[model samples]
Target: MSVLVLNTGSSSVKYELIEVESGERLANGVVERIGEDAGRLAHDGGAVEGRFADHEAALRAILDVLGDISPEAVGHRVVHGGEHFREAVLVDEGVIAAVERLAPLAPLHNPVNVIGIRVAQRAFPGVPQVAVFDTAFHHTIPPHAATYAVPPEWKVRRFGFHGTSCAYVAERASALLGSDLSAINLIVLHLGNGASATAVQAGRSVDTSMGLTPMEGLVMGTRSGDVDPGLAGYLARTCGIDADEALTRRSGLLALAGVSDMRTVRQRADEGDEAARLAREVYCHRIRKYVGAYYAVLGRVDAIIFTGGVGEHDAEVRAMSMAGLERLGVVLDPARNQAPSTGERAVSEENGEVAVLVIPTDEEWEIARQTLQSVRRGAPQLGDHA
Candidate 1:
């Protein structure tokens, strides 16, 4: 049996088909620029470009490409499950309603996630669909770390994002160390377009950089990671800018270096651009601070695993973030750090107190595995395919 995982964004849908037993990816692809003048669907070494009008059309196009592949189950990557969903759940009307109701927490992501679920339910009826949340893995964070010093009536607390990637990489890191996961302490830095740092103690999240939303963590492509709380009000009063829009869409690397992409920022910095240079400093500084903080939280970290786009591919970022951290038992070998390699490998000195590693995250496969488990546990089945 194969499980199909769908990760839906505002204007994009990424999917993968994985064999449930072997965990082998059979096919994977994405539909980009939906609801725009020009949209494209690329799948299994082929590309289809057109003006797709909506998400439904994009999903249908994906199904058309799948042709004869009939996945036994479907998995969705829901951004925010809130406190209601502590784990993956079977998609029923009630679950759908709950996901919709919780959209205020993940305004930009959960709705599109629901759209993917609805479309997939219609396209592959009778197939069990599971909602694998990004926040679920971090639910194990202690109340002291997850809670904020806010009014009790407000009910606001840290709801860490990127738990899916953290979960996958933590397991991979444990295997790479040849150690028992429950005995090892780790700090997982998922540095992607949207970044987060998680402190995993005994295989559970003790603390995470992201708080209440994805925008609270490390500096990201467009989101400002940890700005002063007062800055929002300050922006509103002085600049007439909505705090949410500015922080979520107009800030971070974009506001700092005038470019959201890290590669471009690094290139400009290499050319002696002061702004880009400062941006990289700020970014790496934040990461180092979290690494130190999480090390304290975990007491003795067995490994510091770097994953995601920037963490896995950017050698400079990996090295720069760990700079000056040698006293903390985290040291990087310059040769190993800059080595051209792939998969899971250590970049730190041999026999270092704390192992530094770069592990590629596979969230899609993780989602598919979770979905398959949920299905086998007797999740409610749907009707025939639409």
Candidate 2:
């Protein structure tokens, strides 16, 4: 099946036309700066700079450029599925309403996601559109782990993000280890601008770092992860700062190092910048704590996966994160880890009990795969949801 995957953000939309059977990307592009003067669309080895009034306009332009390739299915990347969707499902009015109700949990993502769906519905009237959620894979998280220590009436609990990446990496880790996913224990660290640590036991998400929203995991580029719960109240009483906005956009490595990009933080840290050094230390320390915590959660982790932008390319960060963990049997060989390598490969010492691997995440491919799978299962046909 050829699936057109759409990941809609607040101000831009990213898309990829993927041929699932052959695992080849048929076509891919991104539309940026919606509702702005500097709008751009980059597709098929070409670029266009123009005005994109809204999501509908951006998608219509893409349709005009795509011309004749009719996808078997259209997949939408909806960030938070809440507790409703456990896997990919065909878009319908009920589904759309459910997603709408969950918008409060992910205000920055889910609303725009539904906008993309509505636009695509107009663009391809009869095509089956699938909503592949980022939180669906963690649906198996046991209640004990998902529960927060808050009042039951408040109702919020951990609904992990990065499920798609964690699921994809865990599958690859099983293949690399020559074991069935259902029989292995693994820890997946998705270290992108937004990061997470998931403990996968027997291919199921037993525990994860992200909670309720994406802002409660390991420190991220702009999001402050795992801040004290009393901060909001304290700040409100003191200076009346909006804690959510500040923490979500003005914290983490950004707040610590005066910049959010990990590459820049590393450079500045290497130059003996105190703030950058502390940022690196705090980031790695948070990861180390999660590694230890999830290790206990899983009991025995067969392999540790490092993925996403920072996890895949930053050797120094990887080294520091796993440092002093030899007792837990995670031994990264200095020679192997520092060696120049790319794609999915191991970096742990050969004799170590746990294998450490660096696998670049393919979220688009995962979304396409899930869409194809759901559609093949005779999932419900798309309805007039928009």
Candidate 3:
């Protein structure tokens, strides 16, 4: 049976229909600008541009287009599972209610994801729907690493995101290294439009860059990662801006360079824009610092794996992030780092202390794989197909 993975966001829904056995994506696309004018639903390797008033409507359009693809199971990427769900779970009323109760933890993600789940549940009755938490993989993180120095009443903690992708890449990196996964300690740099670094020990997340929400850690396309906690209060008191407004809306590379898209930032930097240049430096510097921090955290690092859009494609970013870290046993070969390719490859020097690799992240495939595993474990008689 094919597994359909749905990752719903505040204003977008990214989906993939994957053949479980072979882990092949049958089709995948995203619906952008939900609840806005000129909304779009791009699927089946084609895009449709029009109006979608809400997540429910967008999902209806998606189901209409998925008429011919009869998926037996569905998996949803639920961003914030809080401390409740530590693994992928079959969606049920209890699960949905728990996700709803946890909405405040991921105000920008969980509510919308709940909407997608409910709508899809109605659209495809009886189909097993699984909720895979981004925080799930990081459950293995030791309490010392996950805890923050905050008030006990607040219950605030560092719950990492991009775990599904990290899990997949770490496993792939282990295979590439030909080392036992349980013996390997990997640092995965998931650099996309939204970026993060995860330190994996024994194929489980020991620490990650993103915390609580995707708005922490690395400087992202739009989200400010790791600013002083006092900045919000300062902005509110001095600049007359509210805390929430200051953080989730107006910050990060957008605030740094007056543009959020890295492509634009890169172009401006190329044209000798100091702000853009500094922005890139700050971005790469943040990554390098995380690498160093994680190195200290892990003590014995194996391979450094790069994934996601920027990590896989942007050679310069990869090189600069690991630039002066040769003393730390991390080195990238100049030629291999710049090699043009979409497939997985190691960009590190031969016999380098640590293998620096570029592995394209396949979050959907991971979700599908986990979903199928959960299904097969529960109901082994289910027919498997690719």
Candidate 4:
């Protein structure tokens, strides 16, 4: 079976066509800058120039690139599944309505995800569409971990994001260590534009840094993580900050260093830029705090896995975050950490008690894998290609 995985954002659409049974990505690319004067589609074949005025237009352009190839099933990345959806499910009218009802929870993502689903439905009529949620994996999080200290009437809980990535990397980490996933504990740091730290014990999430929204976790490119509950009201009373918008759009490394890209921040830090240097420290420090907290939660962590853009590529982040944690058996081998490689490998000492690894996240593959499972019930783990 082949699954087309679609992740629709406000201004872009990321897609991948995978041979789900074999876990081979047959085609993949992104349609970027929708609703802008300039738009581009960069795919396995190369780049194509065009203007995508909307999600429907982008979907049409994608079909043009795909030509005769069609998907048997489609897996869509829905950011917030809320409490109702515990796993990926076949989509229908009820699913779309439910997703629309939960839009307030993920104002920025779910709406666009629905847009992608509608468009994909038109493009691939009669095909099954599966929603692979980003919050579903953390549904196993216990009340003690997921519950916020507030009135029950508020009806808010920590529904962690990056679950597709988490599912992919955790399985790969277990594979790399040659251990049963159910036998070891792990701390997975997914550092990208949106960052999160999850504590997985015995192959299930016990605790995670993100709470209710992606904006509550580790410092991200532009999202503020772990601000005081009172800060928003205080800022509103004083500086008239649109706390919600500012926190999610104009904070983190962007607010601290005047830019959000980790590469740019690191570059500036290297050149003795004080603010940029501080941004790096703040980012790493937040990660270290989560590592230490999760260490206590897990009791014994077998490995620390790093995935996503910054986590896999930024050697300094991997080093600084693990620094002074030797007592906790989390030690990074300097040479290994600095090695230039995109493939999954350990960056920890040869005989360290806790392994530190960088596994490039394959979320689309994970989604396709889950789509297969949803469509064909007893689907086994895909081939050991990664």
Whole-model Cα lDDT of every candidate shown, in order: 0.87, 0.88, 0.84, 0.88
| Cα lDDT tens digits for candidate 4, 136-209 | 99989999998989999999999998899998999999999999999999999999777999999888999998
Model 4, C-alpha of 151: deviation from truth (Å): 1.1
Q: Give candidate 3's total backbone clashes.
A: 0
TM for candidate 2 is 0.89
For each candidate in turn, the TM-score is 0.91, 0.89, 0.90, 0.91
In candidate 4, which residue pairs get closer than 3 Å at backbone N, Cα or C atoms, i.e. clash? 158-212
Off by over 4 Å in 1: 9-12, 31-42, 45-61, 379-386
Poorly placed runs, candidate 4 (over 4 Å): 9-12, 31-41, 45-61, 377-386
Q: Which stretches of candidate 2 lie over 4 Å from their true place?
A: 9-14, 29-68, 378-386
Worst 10 residues of 4 by lDDT: 377-386
Worst 10 residues of 3 by lDDT: 377-386
> Relative to the unseen true structure, what is the C-alpha lDDT of residue 24 in candidate 4, on a scale of 0 to 100?
82
Candidate 1 local lDDT, residue 354:
94
TM-score attained by model 1: 0.91
Poorest 10 consecutive residues by lDDT, candidate 2: 377-386
